[model samples]
Target chain A: MVISPSKAAARIRAAAVDAFASAGYGGTTTRDIAARLDMSPAAMYPHYRSKEELLFAISFEGHTEALKVVEGADRPGEEPSVRLQELVSTFASWQAGHHSLARVVQYELTALTPEHYRTVVALRRSTTRVVREVVDAGVQSGDFTIPDAEGVTLALMSLCVDVCRWFPAGNYTNPEDIGKLYGDLALRMVGAA
Target chain B: MVISPSKAAARIRAAAVDAFASAGYGGTTTRDIAARLDMSPAAMYPHYRSKEELLFAISFEGHTEALKVVEGADRPGEEPSVRLQELVSTFASWQAGHHSLARVVQYELTALTPEHYRTVVALRRSTTRVVREVVDAGVQSGDFTIPDAEGVTLALMSLCVDVCRWFPAGNYTNPEDIGKLYGDLALRMVGAA
Candidate 1:
């Protein structure tokens, strides 16, 4: 059973995400991740050198993917309310769909090396900036009434980011359902006209 | 110097919270917590027999305190919008002020024993019910226009609960500031008239 280099690396990452999500970055060892994949630590060594390195990889990939999602969902030419609803619902649904991965990526970030941490934080800031720009545009166009752009942006990002934490609770068991609910709520939060 | 048994337990729990926050529950040990207090693990054993026991104590106490704070802040006799503002601001600020403890209590629930998890979750649901009732009341009085009371209530709680994850970011360093911002946003979420 031979796998391509990229395929092997992706498999290792998925296994590591599960391990990290269940036991946390500090509690999970590279060996545990290897065990999950049924690979020996030596065999896994070629892919990830250490636990922190694996965590960095996961964090980097997760944040980069998240930024892409938000950026992809943004239609700058659209009305601010429409832009926000799209941005939020897309981000929220992605967070829910990949919740286990998202949980590890979002919660275990502190375990990354400082350089890696800075890299991930920059990606996060970019994601936040995407939302902020939409909110600012909304406020400027008077399409949305908000008290303060910065605070509203923070709350919006917070609301979407937190979907990973509490999604699948009660009736919110589907990613699309969450997306719809959040989209409507985003409009309400911005006082959409 | 001798410490009262209760005080000793309190000190141990604080040390454990710091340990769990930095190292996570699976990564932290009773010995590490005892080391933080300059006490031997044997001495700490009387108060908390295991790391899981200490976590249960923290979860139980944190949830109990949080329930009290939410229930205390609820002014049922007031308008629904006013009641929600007070509830959200108070809850968000508490999450911020006790962010460290809140982080552990909120994020580490999966590591708790199933029995303990059930106990903590009931407390959480009770807290949610308090907010849900307010949203429901607001809708009944036509004071708030919301697509769904349950979703709105969930978002309100998620917004407040998430303060522990991203408090003190940028200009939002003060708990009161977070409270004020969240309180206003809660009204927007409910579409208060």
Candidate 2:
């Protein structure tokens, strides 16, 4: 089959993500990524300038997608507790569901170039800001009581983000179960009744 | 000064742990580890057979040390709330305090042989059991009103374990501060009064 450049690029990216997720950013080589996609290293080079660039691509895109998920999970005019649960559930579920991509994006931050690292950090801060603001609002409205909104928000994010570290597919609990459970735990952490 | 064999071994292990933490297991080489200790690669091999063995040594020792920290944190006859606080604060602080070693141990599990991985996992499970039993006791005594002790325990551990991933040294927050805050948050998480 004659594949277009965009299609070829997409295949190379998909293979790279899987390779990096399985073998880790440092463990994966461009040759391994190309091997998975049945392409020569020369063919892969056109789509990605280097392995670091490929990692940046996956890390950047994955984190950006995660930000979108959290931003979309928030609702206007909803009770803060209700909003908080939805946000945690949706965010946790997405992490558990797309764990491979999540692992690379979350754990492989050290491998990104300085510019890419800063950009990814900004996206991460935005996500953290979203959660913290929701939490701060909840505390302000008396829907939640927290000693430190930023710390609690970090713990909440940690709880959700760590799901990708341990929750593999075919585990006893599925992503939905984890989401619901984390949502409940998050509410309790925030002192929401 | 001529270093004794045991002292050389210790230095090699220490250097290996640091290299693996910064460069990752796959990216780090025996030469790098030896370079840090001012030894040739050939001299390094007499102490450690391969890079994987060094990684296994650091990982195994790190996990074993973590188990000791958690196990020691539990004080018999204490209230679950108090016990949980101590457990988390000590555990989290250790992770923060020994973050360079902690990072290699926690993040580089895939590099371990299956047997070594299982051994590390057993230590991890025992640590989890210690926390869960404490949480379960709290719930049974009406001291905590958690929905799922197991899930809550995991979340609690996650909150502590993840501090290593982001909290570098010289940051505004110290290990003790994180520990104190997480301890307070854990109490809040379990609905402790």
Task: Highest TM-score: give the candidate number.
Answer: 1
Residue-level error in angstroms, candidate 2, position B188: 1.9
Kindly list the per-residue Cα lDDT of model 2 for residues A61-157, writing each as its tens digit.
8889999999999995899999999999999999989888888888888888899999999999999888988998898899998877777887888
Query: Model 2, residue B100: displacement in angstroms?
Result: 1.4
How many clashes does each candidate structure show, in the order listed?
0, 0
Clashes of 1: 0
TM-score of 2: 0.96
* Deviation (Å) of B181 in candidate 1: 0.9
Q: What is the per-residue lDDT of model 2 for residues B1-193, given as tens digits with 9 covering 90 to 100? A: 9889988888888998878777777788888888897889999888899988888888888898999999999996999999999999999988889888888888889878899888888899999989989999999899998877777787888888888887752232688988998888889889896
Residue B155, model 1: Cα distance from true site in angstroms = 0.4
> Per-residue lDDT for A1-193 in model 1, tens only?
8899899999999998888888888788888989998899999999889889888888889999999999999998888888999999999999999999899988888878889999999999999999999988888898988888888889988988999998789988999988999999988888899
Query: Global CA lDDT of candidate 2, please?
Result: 0.86
The positional error of residue B85 in candidate 2, measured at the CA in angstroms, is 0.9
- TM-score of each prediction: 0.99, 0.96
